[model samples]
Target: MKYTTDDVHNRVKKILYGLTGITLADNKDIMISNRIDKLKRDSKYKGDIMDLLHLVEEGSYVTEFINSFTTNKTHFFREDFHFLDLKNRAIPQLAKSGNKINMYCSASSTGEEPYSMAMTLLEVQDEIGKKLNASVIATDIDTNVLQYAANGVYRYSKSSKEFPEWIKPSKYFKRRIEKNLAGEEILIKVKDELKKMLTFQVMNLNDNTYPFSKNQFDIVFCRNVLIYFSAEDQNKILKKLFSHLKIGGTLYLGHSENPQDLVNYVKRVGQNIFIKEKEAF
Candidate 1:
């Protein structure tokens, strides 16, 4: 019952790695400890930290344990280039071919990214005057974030932290401004159209097999998540994402992510954007 901080930290680190495949450096003691403390307090677990750790090891709070360590930071329209391609290229190609447009947000986070994708798809559909059936599959490893994402309400402020700088509330959100203790807080709720276009699920990219059919997606956004993985994992995920993507489907990575291993399988079409080559299989 009296486990040291080191004992708690090491067990947590191992559990996080086993469940999510995210490696935590030993120097992340403060982060691990802080998160564990928060989990104990928030989970309302009567036992001490070690007891909670033991529960996690035996799979009681595995989801919460994994959620504690996984970073879920995301933004709407975080990168303009990706959406621009969706608006200008992918949507148009699919529309003209009379094919249903499908997209996957591999790291959808709290829904901003997938909501952004939905907005673009709908806008493109409207502009082209096509009745293209379009939908987005949003998946995240963290159930907590996924719940928030599915709820789709936010406290909008001047800061770019919660809301994006360029998203127009008139287009995709039901705007409501109210004065709270913190002063005038703009609460933007996602429109029903955007909400209906997305389906969120819990997923771990580390899994060898995914619950998707081969060549099912026209575009996939695995952005910013690849950097957290090892080199071998990055390659494995890339290959899997490519396999799930249709020939000529698009893949978006983070700006800082190095995807040199995919040089043979994809063609670089834009900044951090790659089009799955037909020869990729």
Candidate 2:
């Protein structure tokens, strides 16, 4: 069946909102078209956009549709200061308390953020001459990205700009030359030591309740992805994240995000950083 741009936009918007709680504004028409068109060409989808939408409704191509539209822009140490704070402040405080550092990296797109966290934790552990038992639970709504994160392989050339400068990549990642259907490409895969510090899983922030118990995580990194959500949804998710964090735990948000709604529960400690208030329940 023939589909107009409006038809495609409305259909895709519904599918995305239903599945991921991400609302595509009217201005995103071109982006939606480009992504869907790319999906058609790359996946060799024979059907029209409407047919693809029908398939998505039936849960046949849901993952592909979500992966195609959902933005997964991430890099190692994307916000360098957060990692710096983790090393210089957070880890030191946790080390002094002698408690295992439990961190959750929500929206860990393809592993860069979590790996950066793991590396910083390792560095702090070495610096303090103490064995800091640090573990990061990385999760994303996109299953495909989670799988990529689990594999712990990334395109080194593309990631060069955002790669952390303090730690040598060679120390935590081994260079590998691999041949694919396209051609030869240089890739960097995370070493076993860094991989051991992370546990990647598939999770949706829109879920009514997360699987984790209350006060489980000492730190939560729910960065970048919150801007895509509606204000009400953002508040809901933030409250849920707050519940998972320990009273004195830290929550790291994207630089552009505001934590005004959470003022009573968390105190702004730094730019885009909020610490759960000691008296907050």
Candidate 3:
């Protein structure tokens, strides 16, 4: 049996929407099929390709597709300079405010960005000296990635090999073998300090309203993911994100993306960085 491309196209769209609320564009056949093919291979499907399609029709396919489709490219300190800027500028000013500082990682893939953020806050722990209470809320649309983030483990795969060792755990991570869901063995660990400050959740950026309101965040790192969205959707997301940021809070975008062309809500801070100029609350 053979599944027509159209059969795959429709099924894949439904699966993406149901699992992650990601609505695939009609023209995304190649992308969808490519992801589905990867899932088939990962699942070790022993049947015909059409039979594999039927398995997808039975549900649980969305979970498998998410495991394959969601991009998880990240590392321990991919952009060390960004952390420097946070330490030098953002953290100090927020500490002065004497408010409980909140940071959000919007596209926090595989946990690196938020963990880096936690480490930055921890770096200033002595300086702030009880003046600031901080927590990093990391959210991603992919539950599969979120699971790995929650586990706080890394194998230093090809995606993460380039990660600089300077910021690597100082007497923290200790490797220990553990069994996976399939009873396979692997080793990984993260520092207790880093683990305590960060929390990961499954969140869709396109959700009409963020669960938390009151414009509470001091910084929101909504990077890279918007490149995959349409212009209208991107604008919608930015507007929603702005409503959740503290008045003087900053929003970080991908290296190549800009919010300037889209709205006047935030003032430019630096490269792909924007600050909300509407008086702090």
The parts of candidate 1 lying over 4 Å away from their true place are 1-4, 158-167, 279-281
Score residue 223 of candidate 2 by CA lDDT. 94
lDDT tens readout by residue for model 3, 1-281: 56678986787676665555556778877777788788888778866656665676677454666677777777765566667667778888898878888999998988978887887777776556754588999998777788888888876443445444444454445566676786745455778867988888888886778888768799998877787666777777777777788888878887766674334667876777778877322
Model 3 clash pairs are: none
Per-candidate TM equals 0.92, 0.92, 0.78
Residue 270 displacement (Å), model 3: 1.0
Q: Which digits, one per residue and each the tens of the lDDT, describe model 1 over residues 162-213?
A: 3344446677888789987977888889889789989999999999888999
Per-residue lDDT over 139-220 for candidate 2, one digit per residue giving the tens place of the 0 to 100 score: 9998888999999988877536776667878889999998999898889989999999999988999999998989999989
| lDDT, each prediction | 0.82, 0.87, 0.74
lDDT of 1 at 75: 80
Cα-based lDDT at residue 136, candidate 2: 97
- Supply candidate 2's per-residue lDDT for 109: 92
